[model samples]
Structures are given as C-alpha cells and as structure tokens.
Target: MTRTFRGRVSRLTAAALLGTTLLLPSSAGAAAPFPYQDPALPVATRVADLMSRMTLDEKLGQMTQAERGSVTAADLTAYRLGSVLSGGGSAPNPNTATGWADMYDGFQRAALATPLGIPMIYGVDAVHGHNNVVGATIFPHNIGLGATRDPVLVEQIGRAVAEEVSGTGVDWDFAPCLCVARNDRWGRTYESFGETPDIASSLTTIVTGLQGPALGGPASVLATAKHYLGDGGTTGGDDQGDTQLSEAELRAIHLPPFQAAIQRGVGSVMVSYSSWNGVKLHGHQYLVTGLLKGELGFSGFVVSDWNGIDQIDGQSGFTAAEVSAAVNAGVDMVMVPTAWKNFLTLLRAEVGNGHIPLSRIDDANRRILTKKFELGLFERPLTDRAWTPTVGGAAHRALARQAVAKSQVLLKNAGGVLPLARDNNKIFVAGKNADDIGHQSGGWTVSWQGGSGNLTPGTTILQGIRAAAGPTTTVTYNQRGTGIDGTYRAAIAVVGETPYAEGQGDRTGSMSLDRDDLRTIATLRKAGVPVIVVLVSGRPLDIAAELPGWNALLAAWLPGTEGGGVADVLFGVVPPTGKTPMTWGTSVTQQPINTGDGKTPLFPQGFGLTY
Candidate 1:
C-alpha cells in the first residue's frame, strides 16, 4: 500500500485516511519549513539551522573523533559520533580497497541513521600515498620530495594520493607535516619537507592538490597541516620534547610553513604533542586560538594529535582537568582513540559544571559542521568506487619512479666511477636495502613503524639493476657482501637505517652508520672493486669518515616503492638533480647545523653532483 504526498496520487486510500503526511509536513506545520534539509539554502544558513536543532549530546559527538578499533556501528549511532579513524596498520581483515569501502560504508550508515543524519568523516595517516592499504603506490617521504625541489611534482603526487584515498572511502588525510625540522636527530625528520621554512612554504602546492580549488570537488579530501609550531625545533631533537625558543625564533623557524598552509585554504590544523618552553600546545589557548585562528585568519577546525591531551600535565593518562583545558583551548576535534568514552564523560561533566563554556562547544560544532557541509557529505557520503582501480595503477607507479629519480642526490662520483657499463660485465649488489621494498620506503608505510623485506608489492633496487642490465651482464645480490670478489666490476652497497617512527626512532647518541653496514662495505672494499655506496635513510647519516673510502655515493632519502628510479640514476638513464634539503653535518656534535649558520658542513644544502 503506497501513499503519496504533495501532488502525487496515493494508491493506499486507507493509509491516507490514517492521516499520515509523506514528503512535506502536514498543513498544520507548513509554516515551519525545514531549511537544513533544503538543498537550495546557502551552506551557512543550513549549518546554522542544523546547529539550532542539535542536542548537547549530538554536539559533543560532533566534537569527538574515535578510533575505529574502539568503537562499533552501534556505538556510533547511539552516541552520534562525528568521525572515525583507522590508526596506522588499522585496516579491514582483507585490507583491500573494497574491504575498506565496506567498513567505511557500514560506519557511515550508522552515523546517518542518527536523528540528525550527520555523516561521520573518516581520517587516516595517508601521509605518503594510501600507505596503509596494500598494493597502493608508495611515494617518497617528505625529505626525499624536498630533495627533488619540485613543487609541481609534489602537487601531482598529492592529487594521486587523494584519488587513492577517496577510492577507499576515507575523507580526511593527516598529512603535509609542515614542521620545519631544525635537527636531523628528530625521529620525525623524514616527515618534514626540509629544515628551512622556505622549502615547506614552497611545497604548499600540495594543499591545493589535495583539496582542489574548493572543497567538495570530486576526489577532494580534507588536508591537515600538522604538529603546529615548534615541534621540529625541539631541544636535542627529541620527539615530543620541549622547544626552548623565544617567540621570535619560533615565528622564524616553525611558523612560516603553517602560515603558508593556512593561506592555501587547508581545512584543518593539528596541535603538536611537543611544548614551547614548558607549555603544552594542546592546552595553549594563546597559540591555538589567539595566534592561528585570530592572527592567521584561519577558519578551519583544530585537531589534537593522537592522545595528545593526556600529556598536558605530563601524566600517563588523561584526566578531567586535561579534557577541560584542551577543549577550552580550542581543540575542536579530540582524537582520544581508545579512551573516547571517558573523554566524552569528562567533557560533558566539565560543560555541566561550567568549567567548559557552552559557547566553546557551539563554536567547535560550528567549525566541524561547516567543513562537513562544505565537503557535501550530506549529498554524497559514500566511497567513490570509480577511483579504486587507480590505487596502485601503473601510471601512479611511473610517477613515483620519476619522483624517486628526482630525489636521488649524487653526493660523490669521483673519477667518473658511476654509469657502470650494462653489458659484458658483472655487478654486485649488497646490503639490507638492496632488495627490500620496505627498507627503502621507511616509516609510516603499511604499518606505523613499517617493516623490512617485501612487506608490500614494489620493485626492489636489485630487480631494477637486473632489468636495466644488458643480456650479457649479470647482477648478483648478497645482503652481507660475503660473495664479492675481484671479478665484479663494482660493488653497490645499499646500506642504512631500518624502519622506525616518532619516539622510537629518536637517536640521542651516535648517528653514524651501523657496524654491520661498515663491515659490509669493508667486505666489498676487500674485493678490490669500485665501491658505490647508496644510503637509504630518513635523515643525513654521519658518514663523513667513510666518504673517502667509497668511489661513488648517492643519498636516496627513503625513496619509497619505486626502486627502479634509483637504478635509473645509477645507469645514467637520468641525471642526478636532487639537492640535500638538510645540511649534512661533519659529525654528530654539529646536530643543528643549517645553511648560513657559519659552520662548515660535510655537504651544503642544495649540493648535488651530476653524471
């Protein structure tokens, strides 16, 4: 029995007699039109109307962002959660593009089923391509991209990454870590574009690539400028350490990149876990609200780093006081992860006690809902499956290869030892990174810390060398450099750090090559063959003492997935054009060295050799 509203005729007269209204509200309530549901209303008008109708619980939910593992669909609907995120390595059982889409859709359905029908946004650390997904193209980390000095190429990579992310139903990317790294020993050095603010500023083109000219465009995703002010300038290069800089120094070194990001219309800013002097950024109202939102004219919402609120009082876990402080400080979205329920309870109590203002709560919801409206989530909130096939397509891989080639900085090529003949010769490839895709990709890969050896599908440098070799040439690989002999023309020792991220990767002591790498190079040196050292590292390693021993050297800064690009420069298919984005210090003691700092470096910034 179908009953029609408006001008349409109803087949079920009996149902009509029951006085049920269909499309429009009955004549009694006709004077009050639902402006929020009307597509013709301006976005601002719609947002206001929707806010006017939301309850306190719904508004609080809109301010919260829960991790997927801790929350279920039932939880989302019951609490009206506004967002969900898959932490690094958090994926569906299958972990395929379709599997992700299904998971996202299920959560989204639950979110929409709430009384207000607000769609929940999903975020992931897709910092370097759709990194969490298997079979997705992995581009070089920011340090490698910075070496390329190609903003246009970076924008293209951003667009490709956005497409892949959209295909999987994720709407937000916690990316473009705009921290201007001041020290190489920082575990997150690879996340930064370079040490200087100029590099990070110039690369803001990635913002436009991710968001397009406007929000809600096809394939557009929310972009986040992260670890706001002084995170990269921490004392002693410690992860989540304090930055003991004056206001002027902080503005000079770390603030410019975020200013550039704001100008690019980036949708969100992430608060840093690190502190300035002694004040934690999560609770710093002056910076989060007064500076970024007020002085910088940023209209976007601010998100807290993963469980960042817990560290406000240097505590192991978060307290009600911490929650109140963070919310009052203008963190619109709280990434509580596992403790989201506790966060909600604390926040509600705070608000009820007037420790947190209703005005602040409304402001947070307004900022978050505005972006959701701009994203057109109400109109189209599901995964755009059409883009799924582009995840690890050949074209993206080709672009990655090109980026890798451009990122290779040839530090030394003494006596023209490179461009090794491809035919009628034998090449020896040795060291841990020579044949491992994961080793070259570095951290923030499929998993948070990443792993070694064929962790994902990609071309290894050894495979590229063999593919580029002529029919008469042979390529042999021995990870430990044990099989090298005088018969080999040259020994390519690809050695460097394994995968690590954040606090786990911070090195407070020696920053030089490991003993195993030195031994491997020594083994190749014993063979009496020309030794070419390729360093696959996140930052500059202390290798000045070993420089004179190698015939040639290439700084391949975490060239992800496409190892063929490294081979291209090695075989002369492409000229070395990348420059060192960070100054290579002569020793570990010169930790904070930079260009124009008066101290001599092992290699200056922008220094690279040609073929």
Candidate 2:
C-alpha cells in the first residue's frame, strides 16, 4: 500500500514552528549566510536571494528536465522548466558535432525565455564516448575498461569523453556508474566495472577526470555518481525490482564508491529506478534524504531516472497527489521526457497548499544552480568552435584503438593457435555482429537500444580483417553463423547477444549455449581448422560447459563500432593483455563469487595469460 501526504500551507505548523524565515540558510553566527557556507562564495546567498524572488511556477520549472526535440523553447517558457537532457537516441537532424551544438543552443534559447532568464543545463549519457552523435569516437564499454585496471587510462578516457561531449555544448554526464554488479544477469552489467566495490571505486577515476579541482578545467564535464545505492543488486536480478538488503549490507557493498566519488567532488547524482526494500527509491526519504543528503553530505542535486517518478505510484498509481509526494521525497529534478506539464501542475498546487515546504524547494533550486555556477555557465553560456575539430579527430580514434586493444580479454589460446594467418587466401567470418557496425557499437549508440545493421561510421571486423590481410585474403561474411566450408586455413566466429537497454534485457540464470551457437561452434571445430571464438557479451555466461573443444577464446565485452580494433589483436598485430573484469563461473550454480573465494573462477579477476 502507498501513503500520500496532503495538507495546505496555512495549517502547516511544520513551517510555522520553524520560523517565517524558513527558507533562509542557517546563520553560522549572525552575519553568516549559512551554517556551512559555500567556500566558492556566499553563492548560496545568491541562490537563496534568487529563490526568494521566484514564483511557485518558476520553482517547479527548476525541478523538471525535458528531452531536446520532445519540446521546444516555447515549452520551456510555457512550463518554466529548469533543465534539458538528450537521451541515447535523441539528437539534431543531421546529427553531426556542430549540428548538435546548434541544436543544444536552440533549446537553451527557448529555456532562457522566462522572466528570470535562467539558462537550462544540457545532459547526455555518453556512456561509451560521446556515443549519441555520429562520427563521435565510441570507446569500449565499462566492463572492458574494468579489465585494463589502469586508473590513469580510465581517467584519460573520462577526459576524452568530457572533451568530446563538451564540444557539443553539453555540460553534464550521467556516468561512472558506481553499481558493483553482483549479478551478470542484469542487462546493464556491461555498464558496471565489476562485482566488487574496490573495482568500481577504481574505475570511478572518471569522477576526478570529469570534474577538475577548480572547475572549467580540461576534461571537466560535471560528473554524476549515479543510481545511488544498490541498483545492481535487485531481487531475481531484475533491473528495477526490490533490492532486499540490510542497511549495513547496503552501505558496505554499494555506498563506498559513491563516497569515494563524492570525495573527488562529483558535481551531481542520479537516483535509482529500483526500490530499496518495499518502497520505490524515488519515494524513499530515508536513503535519498537522510543517507545521501544529510549523512553523506551530498550538496549536488539528485535527478530522477527516465520516467522514474511514475514508478513511485506504480504503473496504475500515477496521480497528481503522488507526484507531489515524490518531489518532497528529495527528488530535485524529474527527467520528465514526456508529460512534464502534469508535474509542474502538481508541484505548483503542492507548494501553494504547503504540502512541500518552501525551504525544501529552495534547497533543490540551490543545488541545481550551484552546479550551473560551478560549470561556469553564467560566464560562458555557449560552446566555442575551437573544440569542434577535436571532437572525433585522428588522435581520438587512436586512443579508441588502444582502448579496444587493451579491453579484449583473451580467455583461451590453445597451443598458441591464435595470431591466425592474415596472409591466408580464404578466411571465413561468420556471425550477425561481425560486419554490422550497430551490433558492434551495442546499446546507447545511434538509437537508444542500439539498432541492427551499420548505423554509424566505422570499419567492422570484416573490414578490419580485410584491411590487415591486404588484397590477397578473401573474406566471406555470414550473418547467421552458417556456411562454413572449412576449406579455408582458419575460421573466426564473432557471436553474442543483440543490443538492449535496462529492464528489457534483464535476466537471471540459464545462460547456456544455444543449439544454433553450439552448431556454429561445432561446424568450425570439426572442419579440421583452427577456430577463434570472439564472444561479445555484457555478462559472463556458462561457457565452461562448451569451451574444452575450442582452439582460442576472446571476451570482447561489447567492443563498440570499431570491430576492426578486435581484428588488429586477432591476427597478431598486437598481443592480448586484457584480463577478466568479472569472474567467470564454471556453471550457473556457482554464481556470485567474488575475488576472495577459495574456489577458482573459470577465469579469476585480473587473470590474463599473455603469450
């Protein structure tokens, strides 16, 4: 059952008892604007003063974020919303770097139309490079980077992501996912570093890389420590189901990375879509308020997940009253990709009726404004053209190539059979993802849940292999993993899961070898030829049941767009040094084992046998 808090402003003894100056920051003494003043300035005072002048409508606007094309500048003025975001697929018409910058400027043009003229902050996922825009250099997914275990390399990657993203006028990045993925069955596991807090903490080198010591420093892109608490530890390994854990378990396992990120001065945080126990995280006051805000001392604004506020009341329970409850529960901004007007209406009524205290509203607004100020948005409201050429230049792609090479974990290379003959006259490349750029890029690419076929500009493994082998080698492509003649010197099978996002791909157990996959592997193995199995998947599966028959194994972990990079290492141009970011279970039954386990994983974490 859900409870709703509804009361009018006039009868609120909560505010009355506090004082008429409820919204005012606490005085350190008498002249002090706040008990804990912003070292950056009495900027809190400026924010407080700004809040005093805003109407209920404007304050509601500050708590809302809309997509780029979903609404226009007119909508911003009409609703007085504070922030704007571009989801995975959302982009300008042409979808070029300059085109995206112009598109962003156009949206801000509308958002600043209000009486107070506050500029809207733009945000994007950019999980693997500035992936939304075409021609942007797509990097290896987090799971791949986790294997590198080089904090300095990860930090450089973060800086590269920021430089590219900021080139398009975007300031906020919802990245450095702190979730220690305890289960690979979760679809978003590839987004996480590993199943240990220490690994996740180390990968959070991006926090320092994104937000520099001062602000506006190179590679600084307003980092967000996301999906607060245990987003990766849901019941039955579901994406947004109940995460059953004691408070102690939650803190020990999940809270440390966020604390570490906070110490690095991460500029923002995004709330999780899952519930902690029985209550939706969006509506949970204890964690978002008492734990993150009060105890952890997070001054950054907490943004909601995509349409996460609606989950508060459940699918059938969305109502005006419930919307107000979520807002008061410590959600500063709502990612209302649609139906934003309803949020504004509910928030205005709640504020006027006194269900939400004015002080709470001020607090939320101040947090949002503080990030904007720290980003130096007030001084430089627009992006310069100087960074445009650097967006996806040759140097960036070189870094991408290095990332791809380092992230490919060679699981098995029996008898040094790999480093296959690139000079061979006949080479059989069979799999759906081998030549397909979209499949190579995986989720959050050109489209939200990454489409099939070549959606972006990049060379596929087929292309890369051909390039490396010169004109003499004949490469045959098969999407269905069939038509293996075995007449060739060798065969390369690139097979894995298709693209998916969040709850859509969430699964538990039963990651077995399919009949089709088994057939493909068997055909190549029986051909009296060497088979190089490049397994590209988000989660480590039950490969132990089927691996003894293979000549070589490579865990590519969703290598994006540049399947050619995989080709470079496959043919002996570069040695494979990448290790297993997560432990591979021998079977489905031996799941959830960490590094400290006495028993061995099929391949333990940091296990890489280089030849």
Candidate 3:
C-alpha cells in the first residue's frame, strides 16, 4: 500500500510540472525567474522574505553603494555590496552605449553571484540627458527649460532622458534638481529650474514621468530629487555655502519641491553637499532623520552626493568612524568614489560594536529593496535590450533641436540687426565659441568644467552662420583680433564665461566681463560695423557695463552642443520665444530681486523683448 501511494504522488507531481511548463511562454523556455520577487507572491511578502534570509553582512552591504572602479567583481562577491554607481564622467571601458551595458551587466552579474543572488542597482547623473556619454542627446540645462514654464515639455524631456538612460541599462537618474536659485552668480545656476518654489515644484513633474507608475510599468527609471533641503538658499549664493534660515523659512522655501516629489513617489533623495544653519546635511540627524524620514514620511532611500559624506567634518579628515557616523545619520547609500574599503570596514565595525543599530540597517536595505521592486527589477531582471534602437535616435535629436530653438531668448534686438540679412554678403564670426563645442556647452559637459572647441562634433554658431548665410556670406573667424577685414555686413560677437565650475567661478558678487572679450566687442563696435553680441554664460553678466557698445544683444545662455540652433533663431529660421528664466539684473546691486520684492528686476523674470 505505501509503494502504491508514493507512485501516485510522483505521478501527480509530474502532471503539475507539465501544467507549469505549458503556462510559461515558449520563448521564455528554461529561463529562471528572478529569485528576489515572485509575482505569485505579494511585494511586501517577497521583500520581507528576502530580508529574513539575508545574513548580517548581506544586510549591511545592501545599505552601501560603491563606485564602479573602486572594487572588482571579486570584491562585490566578498563584500556583497548592494549597489554600484558611475561617478560624474566615469564611463565604461569605451564609453559607448554597449560599453555602458557591458559594464553594468558585468557588475550586476558579480553581485548576483553571491548566495542571495541579488542584483546591484546602477546609477548615473543623467542630469541633462545622460550627458556623460558621448553622442547622447544633450538638452538645455534646467534653467533654460524653466523659461518655457512648460511642465509638460519638461516631463517629455524627462521621458526621453529616461528612455536613453535605461537603454544603456542604468536604472537611476540623479536629476530634477529642485533648487530655487537665489543668486545668478552661483555656478550651478543652470542646474536649477528657477528661483521660485512654485517653479521648482511644478517643473519637478519630470520625476514622475521618469519613474513611471509606482506599481509596475515601462519607462521606470528611478528619479532622485537631489541636494535636498536648502541647497539654493546658502549665504552669498554660495556653492555648498551655509544656509542660515528659520525653520519656517526652510519649510516654506526649500521643502515644497521635496514634498511634491515625495507625493509623486520619487525613488530617492540625495542629501545636499551644503549645510543648513551650520549643520552639515550629511550629518544633520534632525533634518535627515527627524524631518525627511519622520515628518515628511519619505520612504525612499537617502543617498549621499559624490564625496558629500567626507565634507561633514569640514576641516577634519574623513575616517572610517566618521563615515559610519554619516551612515548612521540616515544616508542609505554612500558614494565613496575612492574609499570603499574604508566605508565597508568602518561600517561593519560599527555594526559589530552596536554603534549602529541593526534596525537602521534593515530600514535602509528595505527602502532600497522597495525601490528595486517598484522598478520591477525583481520581475524584469534584464532591461529591455531593444532600447538600443531608440538610444540617441532621431526622435530624441528632434526634441533636443526643439529645446535648443526655444531656449534662445532675444534679450535685445536693437535696430533689428539680428534676423540679419539672410542673404548677407559677409558675416564675421569672432570669439573662442565660434567653432567651439565646450565653450557653448558650459559646465558639466564632456568634462566637469567643460573644454573649448571641437571637443565634440556639433555645429558651432559659426558653422550655423555659415550654413544659413548661403553661398554668398563670407564668414571670418579669429581668436585674438587678427582676422578682421575692413568691411562686413554684420559681425556676430560670441562672448561670455569661458569654462568653469563651482567655487572656480565664484565671484565676489559681480559678473566681471572678460577684458579680452570687452576689447573684442569694443574693437568690432568701433570698426564702423554692426556688431551683434551673443552672451553665452551660465549667469547673466552685468552686461549693462558693456551692452552700450553692441547694436543687438542675444542672451544665449550656454546652448548645449547645438550652437547651430542659435543660428536657427538668429537668422529667422526659427523665432526666439524663450524669456529670461532668471532675472538679468542691470547690475550686481540690483540682484536678489524677485517679482514680489517691490523692485522690478532689470528685466522681469518673464521679460524677453523679441523682434
């Protein structure tokens, strides 16, 4: 009787196996479902199960994120690090789409090789359309997009950014910077959408579009609302400056966009590199723990910006103990670009000694896991490989072209010299930016501060002018005032900030014009020629000091890669609709002005007088 009963059970088990095989797709033959989550089980139940099975080492590893090159595949298995990220401009072996994919796949494979087989999440800035990668569609900086005041367009841009980023297997974008820029002199002014809380909040819908549905859907790249809690309100409009604000002011000014982002289910919040009222954001338990997690009920994981944790002690050097302190302060992911071992060893020692609570570790891991699950990473272990067809494809370029065209604001069209004679006989294009890609791209392009001319293949303003001038327009280019002839129909002078970044571009409260630029503009003006000044800069220079010399002025605020786009509007192929997103103050004294300050900006925030 026992033999007969065993035989019957074996037969039934075989029948059930046959039914399961029939249920799955034939194309999905022999594929193993990701062990992290089973659709047959509830999401919460799956997360809990995964957490329960993880060892203490695994849990701690889940709470940390290491840079890509800091450790090899062997270290990933040994340490079982939960995430890996490419720091700014950190590319794969070749920096191509396939290169990014291969790098991501290799790292993920290593992490999954551990006993739990959990995949590591990869992240990049993708701040302006996967910008670190060569040939990716570089869009207008956030400030330019703010001028459109079109949240829908911003969302569309976000969607395109998501598609391109995810195409290369990246799952997170540190973007939709919700900074209400208080000073134009801030080098990172281009990164912020606007100076008002409303604009920041409204424009941040890009987060929703990028992340997609909370449950599960395509186009689901995790969005991070970054540099959290008063990054823009720093003293002297400083980069990483101290923001001394009343609690009410903090809540009213900086907290709204975070709140809005949270409501939209933003996947993560990167702690600011700056301090709030003398408290370092990376070490501020009151804000990171009490406010962000407790009061605001943010369930998303908190990440530290690049080397942000190290800056906590200010003058004091960062040690393992200090890193552990910042981790305990509520940073789920630490971007220790060069010191992964220090973070790992210190964190483990802290956990062992009870300096860091296991509950905190669990909470951090859980938050990250929830985001991964929300991203459907558990279900779709592999990204859609077919995204290659659309990565930096025509549609993205078309949108980038549109963004470029609209971002051109006609600051001045005096004597209607611009929309210059389309059939002009000669147009002299003078300045470093005439044939330069890096100068036009400004900060955060190919390199951190960007380079000058031909760093990448794109039409420079000179190229566009030449293309639009047809066969008759003679274009002359010179760097240091040598290539000038007596007469030309019009001279287009492209001048402004060369190439710089935060702290490097820090001014003592004035937009000092480059003396050489002034000489060039003045020289051209005195040559008995019509000179059109194209100011290419991150901040609005106090051009009133210099504008008296030029016949027409165009505020082309660092139009990226596509300098030809500027000529598109300049020669009347496209009309300039972009108004000044940030106020172009007449002078430094007229700054810090908003709509309600009872004093009008030299040009109101929405001011753009077009021809």
Candidate 4:
C-alpha cells in the first residue's frame, strides 16, 4: 500500500549480503559495528540496515504506539514498542515539565534495553502548546488563530509549541488540525482553521515551524497533518460520523489542506475516525493509500486515530479483518492506547496468515524508521533539557498574548463602545468565563474534555482586565451580574460555552446561548449600564436576537492561558483585528452557513469591525 521496496537481508543472507572484505563475526563470536549505528549514513540506508537485522516481532513493534499509562517501562522493552504517548490528561505523577522529561527518559531507557536498542518516539496531543503539561503555555485554538488570519503568527506559535514539547521530550505533536470546518455544530469546529481550503492551506505554515527547516533541527517536533480527509465536512457536523460527499467535493473542500501540509514536509498524517460516503476513513484504501499516499506522494508514515480501526466494521472493538484492512489501507502506525497488546497480537496473526503482506510491514517500518533516523533519535535519544525552561515561560506567554489579541473579533461595536479607557474606568466583569482559568483555556488544556476552575496556572480574562485596569481604575467581578448599574462605565459579560471536546461538544439542538448566559445578560441589561459582551466560545453562537441589547460584542473564541490579550484589545493597548473565520448564522436553522452558501449570514466570513 505504501510502496515497493528493495530486497531485504535475510538472516541466512546476512553473511552473503555483506562482502567478505567487510568485518565478519570474530573468533569471540562478537559482530562488527552496524552501518545503521553510523550518523554519517543516509536515512534510507540506515533504515534499510536496521530493517535487515529486525525480526517480525521487532518490525510489528515499530508500527505500534501505546499510551503511557497502559504501557509500563518494562512493557516497552518486552514489546519493543516503537512509540509512547501521553493521551489528553494522561500525565506523569508530578506532571511538571521535568517530570515529563524524566518519564520520557525512563521509557527510552526501557526501549533501549531491547536487543536492537531502537529508541522509541514519544508523542502527545500538544495541539495547543504542550497542553498536557500544567505550566506549559496554552495558545488559542485553531478557530481563534484562524480569525487572526495571520499564518506567520501561527507559525511562530507552532515554533513555541514545538520548543515546549521538546522540553518535555515529546518528539511528536498531533497538531495543526487542518480540517476545513464546514458546520458550526461540529464539536471540533474550534480545531479547524476556517471553513475553506485556502485558510487551512495557508495555516500549514505551522507544519514548517513544527518540523523546522528540516527534520531533526533544534526543537523540531514531528508534526502531524491530522484527521486526514474530510473530517470537518461531516453531515450534520457529526463527530466520527459519515461525510456523504462526492469525491470531487471532498477533494475540493478537504484535500487541499493535506496537500499543503505534505508540501511543508509534515512527518506524519493521522487518519480520521469519521467516514466518507459511509465507508470509514480508517479503512478507506482509495483515500488513505491511493489518494494520500499514491496520488499525493505522502512518503511519511500514516497513523490511525485513537483506536480508529475499531469502527471499520461498525463494531465496538476491532477484529482481525479490521486490523488487516487498516494495514492494507496504509496505516503505518496505529494509536492503540490501551488495547496495544491486543492489536499487536491481531496484527501478528494477520501478517502470519498473509492477509497483511510482509512487504507492507517493511514499508511501514521503512517510513517510520526513516523518520527516526532523520530525527537523530539513535544519536540523541534523551530529552534535550536546554529548552525545558521555556515551558510556560514568559516569552511564549507574551507571544500567546499577542496571538490572543490578534484573534479577538469585534463583531459589533455600537457607538464605538470598546477600547474602554483604562484610567478611571469602572469595569464590572461578570459571567461564568470571567475568572475561571479552565473556562478560558477551553478544551484540550490539561484534559481531553477540558474543565473549569484552576486546573493549571494561567491568567484568566478577569485577571487580565484587572491588571490592565491598573490602580487608577476600579474593577469588580461576579459570577452572575448581581451588582452592576449605570454608575459603572460598562458591564463586561464574559459568557459562553464551557469546556467540551468532541462528542459532548456537538450541538445537534439550538446553537443559542444557554439559559444562564441569557439570564446573566438580562441581569446586566436590567442595570441600564452599557453591556460589553465578550463571548468566550469555540464557535460562533446564534446571538442575532441578543445582539441589539448589548452595547458591544467581542468574539473571544477560546483564548487560552493569556487572557490578557482580550484585555489588551478591550483597553486599547491592542486594536481588534481578528476577522470571522466562519460565517455567523442568525439562528440554528441556518446551520451550515458559509461564505458561498445560499443562506444569509448574520456576519459573513472575514467580517470584522475595527475602531
């Protein structure tokens, strides 16, 4: 499915393969040094040399990625795992940057203990700035970054994220989700850049930043061009649901981002859990193998989403057929998480039965091992702690602040109500998202389905507002708009969706503000004070009916850690420049509204009001 390869060195052919002039097994039964161990050798040559010496068990291990919690250090060596990963919220005991580094080193040591001594690659959902670690700098989600429409800034953020991830010894980042979010109701809409191939394609600059000028550069992490094709265009904005589209439509809307990503030398491509035309993507040979690999010439290894192969047969757990189908479909490495052992067994059985050819295994190994060699993992396997200090450091936070500021979309500023003067400004902040760090950070912060309260250390929007307000200004806050009046210059209501990742975040029903938000706005309106509504959400909420009652509206789409960016714009330190990445619909009825769509939008794509 990947490609045809050259002949391999069989165990019996080992002596015949290398010329007799080369060093042979000595009288002491010790062997000569391998070419694969030499750093000067080419990556393909090293991969070939290594593959020649590998057994079937070792080759299978190279194609498997196990979760950190499920696979112990001993298990790593026993299985000879090719990769280790910390799933969202799956962290080490201390959970600090150093703790992560120590954990990564421990696993590396176990992996090196194997006969082949192949160093395992570690991966994380560092989608938004080493999000699993507590103190790592958290950046705005993709939708927010898309609103900024600044690929250069996004690339800078990607570099910062790569550095932070490197500090934790995480060699791979499953990030820069290039999904062209077509529907507002999709829970992962925040993960997409915008509702077009062009926006997503432009943002693939992040892949370059993540991988550096080339693979193995300083702080360079293996970037993944994710959920491979047509994840964001699913019917009804479903999570892991069918995307019933003709091949042409899929290629036009969804394929371009991946094309752009591959051009940037993205190290891997993660297959989507969702299906296309009722055929699951994990098992879609035409798309994954034929289109992505053959047509597009994606030489990098293809990876499966978290247990994505299980859905190939529309079943709860994966079967041998699914395993063979996935491998035959060109999924080089599988993210088995907890079920890695079962997967290894099934894959071995499948390979033994000839369902998955040995050549496919070799191709998978060659692609994966080539990256490992290119990464210089064999030479520098340990965590590079030099970049450790930058995790959640001031510089990255400043960049995040700038990004957050740039991401602020001012949808409505009636009578120029924003740029609220800092000095002598009586700002009353209220609503659920005002002071909560977890709320501001949104999903994929410390956990998969990110939560509220102080889950990690970062500035909340209210904290940012107070700091910006300074000593001369008076700043008051409440969860609800209990105490606000015309006496205050403006009542800032920071209200929107709480944390939700995939399935739970999907809003099949009305996409309007919750009752709590509506009630809070009513309470603020009751005070007869100017209401400055700062909506902190992943996607645009249906707020046309409520827009008139508010004095001003700022779409602060899930600004992570550095909430001060929102404050910077609010107090005129930074002018609002973010444009709407997606069209804002008046009501839930206009569900799939976009730039070219026939339905009238409340705010068209790229629309933004600037003072």
Using all chains and alpha carbons, the TM-scores for the candidates as numbered come to 0.94, 0.89, 0.90, 0.95
Q: Write the per-residue lDDT of candidate 3 for residues 66-96, one digit (tens) a residue.
A: 8887878788888888888887667876877
User: What lDDT would candidate 3 get against the real structure?
Assistant: 0.76
How large is the C-alpha RMSD of every model relative to the true structure? 5.5, 9.2, 7.0, 6.2
For model 2, the superposed segments whose C-alpha errors exceed 4 Å read 1-42, 421-426, 470-487, 591-600
> What's the lDDT of the predicted structure labeled candidate 4?
0.88
Candidate lDDT scores, in order, read 0.88, 0.76, 0.76, 0.88
**Candidate 3 or 4, higher lDDT?**
4
Candidate number that wins on TM-score, 2 or 4:
4
Residue 151 of model 2, lDDT score: 83
Instruction: Compute the lDDT for candidate 2.
Output: 0.76
Alpha-carbon error at 375 in model 1, in Å? 1.0
Candidate 1 yields a Cα-based lDDT of: 0.88
Model 1 worst lDDT run, 10 consecutive residues: 1-10
In candidate 1, list every pair of residues with a backbone clash.
none
